[model samples]
Target: MNQLRDPCRSAGRTERGRTRARNEDAFLDCPQHGCWAVADGMGGHRAGDVASQWVISSLAALPRQSNFDQRLKAVRHCLRILDSRLGRALPLNASAPYAIMGSTVVALLLEGNRAACIWAGDSRCYLWRGQRLYQLSRDHSLQQQLMDTQRLTRQQAQSHPAARSLTRALGGRQPLMLEVLELCTRPGDVFLLCSDGLYQGLGLDALGRALSRGAPGQVVDRLFTEVLRGPAADDLTAVVVQP
Candidate 1:
C-alpha cells in the first residue's frame, strides 16, 4: 500500500430517532487503535440490542497489539467466539426460546498506508478521497443478492419489495461469512462507517459536501442534520475517520 504524510482525525455518534423506543445501534471509535465499527441490532427480534452491545463490547476489549495482521486475526477470533456463544444460546432461547437477536456489523481498520474494511449485513463503509466519494463495502441484503445474480439491475433493486431485507447478520442461525477488503491508503482520505438508519434518506451530493469539509466532527453533524430532516425510522449511527 502507498503511504501518505497527513496525520489522522476521527469522531463518531449514535442517536435514537423519533420512532424507536430504544436505540439498537452500537459503535466503536478507537482512533488510538485505528479501529472503528458500527453495528445495528435486528429490530424485529427480542433482545436485539443485547446482541449489538455484545459484539461492540467485545471489540472494545480486544487486546492491544502492534502487528496489524495479528489485530485482524484477533478480531476474527473474537467474532468466532461470539458465534459459538450465540449458537449455544439458540436452543436455550428456543425452549424458553428467546427471540433470535442478531446484528449487522461494519468495521474499519487503518494502519499507515493500509486500510481494511470488514462487514456482514447492510452496515456500510465509504471513502472520500480527492474530492470524490466511493462506497467501500457492499450490502448483504436480499435485494443486493438479487442484483448480484443479475436478476435485478441497480435501479430495480432500489424499488424491490425486499429492498431492506438482510440476508446475513451476526448471531443468526446460519454461519457467518465475513467479507473483508484491504486497500492502499492516501493522505487526506476520509472514511465513513454508518448504519442503515443514517443513509436511507441521505443524498450523495450532501454526503460529498460534508465529507469534503475540514473536520470529522462537522461532517458527522451535517450527516445527522440531513438525515433527521426526514423521517428517522430507526437508530442513527456514524463514525468518521480521516487519515
Candidate 2:
C-alpha cells in the first residue's frame, strides 16, 4: 500500500470581482488542521457576507483530528450552528423571494493518503493531476437537479437561466443535506476549492490549463489572471492545495 503525503504548497484568493458591490465569498486554508474550504453567500444583501464568514470560521474552529469520521462530525456540528445562527439573524418570510441568509460551502479534509470532501449548495472541489482536472464535488443547484433528472444535458443546464439558483444551502428553508466523498491521493495531486463565481466565467479547459501552468502559488495567480481577462459574472475565489 502507498503512504499518504501531507499537504505541501497551498494558495488562495478571494476577489469582489468587477460587478459586485461587496464580496460575499470566504475561504479557509488551514493545513495544520488538515482542512480547506470556500464559501459563497447568496440571498443578496440580507446577510450574505456574514453567512459566508461564519462558514469559514466554523470550519476553522473544528478540532484537528486525523480520524475522518470524527472530522466529519465536527463539520456537521459547525454547519448546524451556522444554520441556527444565520437563520436567526435573517428571519425568513414566506412572502419574500430571497428571505433566508445562507451560503454554499465546500470543504476538503485530508488525513494521511485519504481526502474527504464535504459540501452544501454549489461551491465545489476539483482535483488536478497529469494535466487533467476532475471536479470532485457536485453542485447542489437547480442546474444539477435538472441534469440528474435528465431534463437537461450538462451543457444545457449550465446555460439555463436558473443555473445559479441553488437547490440546497446552509440556511435555506430545507434541512441541510451535505454531501461527502472520500478519495485516495497521490504526491502530485492538486486540489482546488472554489465558489461558483470563480468558475462561472472560466471555461473548464482553461481552468485545467491554469492548474498545470506552474506550482501551487503560480497556479493560483494564473487562475486569477485568466478570470480578470474575462467578464466576471460574480465574486471570484480560488483555493489551491497540493499534497
Question: What's the lDDT for residue 212 in model 2?
Answer: 76
- Candidate 2 Cα outliers beyond 4 Å, as residue runs: 1-7, 43-45, 93-98
For model 1, residues 19-125, the per-residue Cα lDDT tens digits are 89999999999877778999998888867788889889999999776677877888878877776676555565445664566888999888878888999889999
Model 2 has an lDDT value of: 0.83
lDDT of each: 0.85, 0.83
Clashes of each: 3, 0
Candidate 1 Cα errors over 4 Å, as ranges:
1-7, 90-98
Pairs that collide, model 2: none
TM-score of each: 0.92, 0.91
Worst 10 residues of 1 by lDDT: 1-10
lDDT accuracy of residue 43 in candidate 2: 42
Candidate 2 lDDT over 1-243, as tens digits, reads: 222354457889999967788899999988766788999988465679888998898788776655667787888778877877777776556777567788889988787777889899888899987878999999888888888997788889889887868888888867778888988988778999988778876889988988875777898889899888888768999999987
TM-score of 1: 0.92
Worst 10 residues of 2 by lDDT: 1-10
